[model samples]
Target: MINRDLIEVFSDIAREKNVERSELATILEELFLYVIEKEYGDSSNCSCIVNLDKGEIEIYSEKTIVKEVDDYKVEITLEEAIGKEPDAEGDLDVGDVFVEVIDPRIFGRRLVTTAKQFFAQRLRDIERNYIYEDYINRVGEIVIGAVHQIQGGNVFINIDKTELRMPRNEQILAERYRRGDTIRAVIKSVEFTSKGPDIVISRSDNHFLYKLFEMEVPEIEDGIIDITAIARHPGSRAKIIVKSNDRRIDPVGACVGMRGSRIQAIVRELNNEKIDIINSSEQAEILVSRALSPAKPVQLFIDDDKNYCIALFEDENLDAAIGKNGMNVNLASKVTE
Candidate 1:
C-alpha cells in the first residue's frame, strides 16, 4: 500500500518541523483515514492503522460470512469467506479482513488527487493557525530573529517556521536591519489576513522595553520585582518604573545587575538607547517626578479637569526634562499616566 510511503513522508515532515515523531504519525494517520472515509462514505466498518516504526499502513474492511449472500454490500458468502479464512462463521468472531481490491490507478489518479488537494488545504489552515498561535502567545514579549527580506521598507523576519513583518511605522527610526541581520523586537499583534495570519512585530513598541527588562533582570521573571510603567522614545531614550513587591528585594539594584551588566546588555540591544530605571510611588507627584528622571523639578501641579500636570523646572533642567522636540515630556506623560 502507498501507506508505507506515506509514513516515510510524514517522518520527513516531522523532522523538518521538529515535531514529535508520534504526534506527526498521529496527525498523518488521522488525516489519511479521514480522506478515505470521505471518499468511501461509510467508515464504521473500516479500520486504518499506521505503523510508524515499520513505515507502513494498512486498511481493513470488516464483513460477516453467511450461508447465502443476502446483501452484496455487507455480507460475503460462506464458501468465499472460508477460502480466505477457514472456520469463519456468521455468529462466531471471524476477525477483520482485507483484500487488494483497491485499484492503484483509481486511488492514485482520482482519489489521491482529491486527497492531496484536501490535505493541502487543511495543512494551510493548520499552518495559518500555527503562525497565529506562536505569535499571539508572545504578545508583550521580545523576540530575536533574522531579517530575511524586505518589501516596501517592511522588514520580514524568519521567526521559526513563519515569517513576521515589521512595517515602517512600527520600526524604530534610528534602527536599520539589513538582510541576514538579527533583530530583537516585540510581538505587537497577531492578526488574520486574507492570505493567512499576519504577525505584526515592532521595535518601537513599549512592550519591547518591558520584555527587555523581564529578560535581563532575573528578579522580574521570579516575580520578586515588578515593572509599574514603561515609556520609550524608540532609539533615543526610555523610562521604566519598577517597584519591589518584597521589601527585602532592591528592584533597581537587581535590574541594574552587578556592575551594570544587565542594563548594559539591554542598552546594546536598543542601539544605545538610554534607559532610566526609577522607583515607583503611588503618589502622582512622586511618580511624575520619577518619570521625569535626570532633571530636577521644582513643582508638579496636576490639573484635574484637563488631566495635565504642569511641571516647573529650573532652566537648566528644562531642556533635559523636555528633551528634543518634547520627546521626554511625552514619554513622561505616558509613564506617569
Candidate 2:
C-alpha cells in the first residue's frame, strides 16, 4: 500500500528556497525502474512508496487479479488475490493484489544500494540549477566574491555559493589578485551551457565607473545629477561627463567631495587611476572645450559633420593637450561623444 506520509517530503521543499522534492521523487522512481529493466530482474513488476513520517520506505511486487488466471505472467487468480485482500471482489481494483512490504532483501544487497545512488545524483543536479538561476538574475550588477583558487589560466571565484571562472581575458591587465582576497566586478553575462550557467565578470568595464559615480555622488544617486558618458583605461585613468537636473547643484563639485576624498577612495581601489569629471552640454563648441579640460584650448574647431574636433594651442600647451601615451585626447573624445 502507498504511504500517505510521503507528503512531508514536499512540505520541507516548500519551506526551503529551491529544493523541489516532489519532482526529485518522480525522477528517482523512474531511474530505479530503468536500472531494474536493464538487469532483466523481477523488479520490473515492483513499485515503491516513501514513508516520511517513520522515515522508512518500502517496495512491492504488483499483479492484476483475473477470473481464470490463465496467464500467470501478467495475472493472479482471484483466490490468491482475495487472500491478499479480504474485501477483494472479482472486479476489484488493481490495488487488491499488491504485496505489502516485499522483503527488499529478495532483490539482493546490491539492488537495494543502487536506488540510493540514483537519488543522490538527481538531488545534486537540482541544487546546481538553484544556485545557477540565482546568479543569472543579477546580471549587469556589481557583486563581491572570494577568490577560491587560481587555476592555470583562470581564477575561480565563489559567488552566491557557486564557483565561477574568471579568465585572464576578463581580468584587468595590471591587476593581480591572490587567493582569499575579496574583489568586486560587474557581471558581463550569464551564459547557460550544457554543463551549467557560466557567469562572466569584468573589472575594466566603463560601466564600473558609472556605477561608482552613482554610489559616491548623492546628487547622481538622488537623480539631481546625471552621468552622460564615461571612459576608462582601467588602473590608469578615467573620464566622466555629468550634468545637473537642478539649476543650483554643481555636478562636478558633488562628485569630487571635500578635499577630493570621495573620488580619491575610488582612485585607490583602481591603483591610483585619475578621474576627470567634466560638464556635459548640448553646444558642440562648449562641450568639446570642456571635454578637453586640464588642457586649455584657445581655438576649438569641429568638422563639417561635427564628428571630430580640432584644437589649436600654444607651442608650450600642445604637450599638455595630449598627455602621456595620448591618454588626454583619447579620454576627451570618448566623453565628448
Candidate 3:
C-alpha cells in the first residue's frame, strides 16, 4: 500500500495484456497464497484476499478449534482459538474453524521471489486459456492479421488481440509478407499448450478458397449454391465444383455472376489466382468431363471395378487437357477420385 505505483503498474499491465483488471487480482491472490505456502509449511486451508484498489493483499490461514491438538497446522486448542478471536470463547464450538490473519510481508524476500515465479506461470496459464477461449469457436474461419515477424522462415501474425503462427508449409508460395502488412488466412487449428494456444493459420488451404467464395457470392451465402469440391495449387489456380438445389438455377453461372463481378472479388483476394467453376453432376463421367475443363475429351470409358477411367480426346486438345504442366489433369483426377 505504501507504493501507490502498484495500482498504476497493474492498470498498465491489464491494458497492455488485453485482460480484465480483475484477472490481475486473481493472479495477485494466487501469488500471495504462494508466499503463504513458503512461510507456513502448509496452506491447504489458506485463502488470499486482494484489494486491487488499494494495492493490498492479505493472507488468512484457517484451522479448526479442538479440545486437543493432534496436528498443529490443522487444529488449534480452544484457548489458542479464543486468543486469536475474543468472541470465540462462547460463540464458537470445538469443531468450528477459526481464521488467523497472517502477515504476507513476513515472507519478505522469499515473497518477492516466489511472487514473481507464481505470477509468471499463472499469467501464462491464464493467457493460454484466454487465447484458447478467444479462438476455439473461430476455427475454420478466415481472419485478417498483420505481419508481426518472420522467425526461422516462419511467419507470425498479429491478429485482433494476440499473435498466431503461420508455418512455411501453410503459406502460399507466391505470397510474401512484410512487417505490418495486412494478410488474410483461414484458421486451420488451435492447439492449447502450457504456455499458450498455438494457433495455426493458412492461406494455401483449399478451405480458404471455399470461404472466400462464400464471402463474395450471395448465392452461396443464401444456400442456393453449395460448393462441393475444391482442388487448389495455392496462389496459382484452382478448380471448384458447385451445385444448386433448385433446378432453375445454374450453379456455375450463379457463382461467376454477371460480367464476372462476383468471382472477380474472390480472384482479387487470392492475388488474381485463376479459378475454374464447374457444375457438379451425379454421373461419374459427367463430373469427370466437367472436372477436366478447357479440354473436351471426345470419348471416355469408365471402369468402376478398377476405379479408373480412360479419357480420350482429340490430339489437338491434348496440350490443353493436360494443362501447361498436367495441372489440369491432376486437379481433375483429384476431383474425380
Best by TM-score: 3
| CA RMSD, predictions in order | 5.5, 4.9, 3.6
lDDT against true structure, model 2: 0.73
The local lDDT score (0 to 100) that residue 155 gets in candidate 2 is: 77
| Model 2 C-alpha lDDT per residue in residues 1-337, reported as the tens digit of each score | 3333434544454346455556655654565465555454456577766544454456555676666666554477667766766864555654346453454445566654665566556666676677678778877788789998988868788876787777787777788889999988777788777677787777788877777777777888899999988887777888888899998988888889999988997887677888988887888888878777788899987984858788998888888789889988898888777
Candidate 1 local lDDT, residue 161: 57
Which of 1 and 2 is ahead in lDDT? Answer: 1
lDDT of 1 by residue, 1-337 (tens): 5546755765675575556666665666666657657767765665666678877666666666566667544567656765665544443433334232232234566656665665566567667877787778877777889999989989999977588889998998898779999988888988888788888888888877788888989889888899988888888988888999999888989989999999999999889999888888878888888888778799989976787898999998999898889988898898877
Report the C-alpha displacement of residue 21, candidate 3, in angstroms: 6.7
In order, candidate lDDTs are: 0.77, 0.73, 0.84
Provide TM-scores for the models. 0.69, 0.77, 0.83
- What is the C-alpha RMSD, rounded to one decimal, of candidate 3? 3.6
By summed lDDT, which 10 consecutive residues of candidate 2 come out lowest?
1-10
How does residue 166 of candidate 1 score in lDDT? 96
Show pairs that collide, candidate 1.
none
How well does model 3 score by local distance difference test? 0.84
